[model samples]
Target: MTIQVFLPSQFTAPEIFPVIRDSFGTFSEIPTEVDFEFSNLRFVRPSGIVFLSNVARYLHRSGCRVTFSGMRRETNCIRFLDDSKFFEQHIGQAICEGSSPRSTTQPLREVRHEQSHNWLRSTLIPWLSISSQVPEHDLYNVQTCISEIFNNINDHSSQDVGSIFAQWYPNERRVIISVADFGQGIPNAVRTVEGELSDPLAITRAFDNEFSSKSTPRNRGVGLFDLKQNVVGRFGGRVTVHSLGGAVEFRNVDGSVNTSTYNVNGYCPGTLIDIELSTDRIEITNGERESFTWI
Candidate 1:
């Protein structure tokens, strides 16, 4: 049987969860074909972009014949999708033709485990240089945090490729970066080592500085911990992780750590990390810096 899903006009985080739940339900029924309708989609945030791409990737991987239709031209929605290569990644290149001229206003790209280093050095750093006005020294911290996230996907997840979307809001002086992977999520990964654990507890433990699921001699579990410290503790931003059926959000506001976690209606099936950094708060003072090198 064929299932037709209509996307919302304004696709943003928290609000788009309903669509995601419904889509997952439809796909779980093992539909012969899935058609995504984008006729009314006028605006989409970075989170929505990642969510949509991840969903498409998931559906495609699940042996469903997926097709996209009803994408209206002469709209910011179509332009954003075109520039981000969303159609090419999710649907196909043929459908992307005459969609719209690629928008240069934001930097959004996909990252693969094999090319993580190159992506960091070439795409991410250069984009930060122009968009955030972040100094060279401070760039190391950003690189370290993001690199850890990528490494986690490589080391922990079953999937190798993931989507990354970033946008800088000049008026707000903040940059939002979103990364997503369609893989075995945090809860299942942690359960392998720590025995049975709830999704929320597993996500919380995954961020602990002493938690590592690897059996190697040097398996210091500081990736997520250090990411939280750099993005939230130091930069005074927000870091959110959505894995499986649970979601956790961390924010450092007024020098205080604020965190919240809740359960979603349906499982995410993978992981999604959303980070927001305040450009005005990031101090680029001259000081001793750690070697900004990575494999």
Candidate 2:
């Protein structure tokens, strides 16, 4: 039997999570075809685009014939998604004929653990440098902040790959970035370390500096805490995380870091870290590259 999945009006998180759970959660391997209908999709965010790409990548690979339906009705959304390389990377063809000139975003990409650093240095940073006018040297801290996410995914995830996308909103002086993996969600990973806990509490506590899942008591979850601290506490940005059934948001208001959590509609398979960073508030480095020591 083929599953009829309706892409929502707003292709963003929280809203999309429920659809994901209902549509694909029960399958050990997707046993039927999927029609990812985009008929009503209007506005799409960075994470939302990656979610679409992620679904296409995972479902197609599972031998589930996926069809990206109903595009002509929403020309603008389809064009923007096409410019972001969503169709190209997923369906292996461009849905829209031409790219948008106002498309100030990187194409959605799936990067494995091994190629992450190079993708950061070669593609992401350079894009940011040109768009934000922050010298590549000055953006090292930004690079470091995102690298921590990669480390966390690499350490915690069963899959070596993760989907990533970023956008620069010139008028708002904001940069939105998202990375996610379809491995075990954050709450599931945390449950392995700390006994049984509610999904909301699991995600909230996962930000603690001392909390870890490793036998050696090293920090992948805490590294995320540091990422939150650096992004919000230092750079005055915001982070929203959706792992399984919980949603946690870290926002910087008037130089203060505020955190809030909520229960999502349904299970969001893995961990998605979505960041809204401010280009105006970011601190630039001295153009000297700083090497990291994992040990």
Candidate 3:
């Protein structure tokens, strides 16, 4: 199981609270009241310690024992009266095993904008190179989806200084691409620009039609919205966003939306987007039966 902590980075607490809660429920199934232990810890900012400590207190009151395997250094622990877990022990295995050594590199600013583009180009070109063997329609759609996600990170997540560290597990046909920064998360950014948006699900709604952070000269009105439309509506895939104290799941089959809010242990920043593409779908692309790459 994974324990995620969300704190204000660029986004405010209220805005991201619902997002975090939704995510927490999505990842876990409510079990009977008992002591539960988890090995994974994900923290965004140091301020998240307050929220986590509060969670520990609440869990104790509920007669549920919650023990975190590790703490995230990025989180603020000073606010907490007691240290809960070792920050590195649990996550070290997941990070080491899932990550690709070559994938770790310089920050986004160090590389030219085109460098990012080229990174994607390299990942996509090989697939396109074997276009003759694959269905052109599927290739077009998959490329579009990947481009939408990559462009979103470059445009919004990168900001002035940031980096994209992603690890793609070709075996499982799963890609975990994380665009992190000391910048504001999506929820907080939206709240600042749009006067009090009471909808705690604003971040989830952003994936729906017409929801965007851009105010002026909103042209095309595509990208993320289109990505959702194609991925869920067309391809049978799932989209998840872990930010604040909530998690939002966009299920593709029936266009169903699931949301929940739960208390996380610490303040964490930025966003980590994980996409699960079917092996059956990936095989239909390019020449091989099972092959995938990330830019």
* TM-score per candidate: 0.88, 0.92, 0.49
Tens-place lDDT digits, model 3, residues 6-96:
3333322233344445544422343323222222323232223222333333344444545443323333331111222212221222222
Predictions ranked by TM-score, top down?
2, 1, 3
Candidates' lDDT values, in order?
0.76, 0.80, 0.41
Candidate 2 versus the native: TM-score? 0.92
Q: Where in model 3 is the C-alpha error above 4 Å? A: 1-114, 124-138, 154-178, 198-200, 217-219, 254-265, 282-295
**Per-residue lDDT tens digits of candidate 1, residues 164-227?**
8887777898888888887788888889899998887898888887577776613364578888
Better of 1 and 2 by lDDT: 2
Quantify how close model 2 is to the true structure by its C-alpha RMSD in Å: 2.2
Ranking of all candidate structures by their lDDT, best first: 2, 1, 3
Error of 1 at 187 (Å): 1.2
Candidate 3 vs. truth: CA RMSD?
13.0
Clashes of 1: 0
In angstroms, how far off is 122's CA in candidate 3? 1.7
Q: Against the hidden true structure, what lDDT does model 2 obtain?
A: 0.80
| Candidate 1 residue pairs in clash (backbone atoms < 3 Å) | none
lDDT of 1 at 179: 86
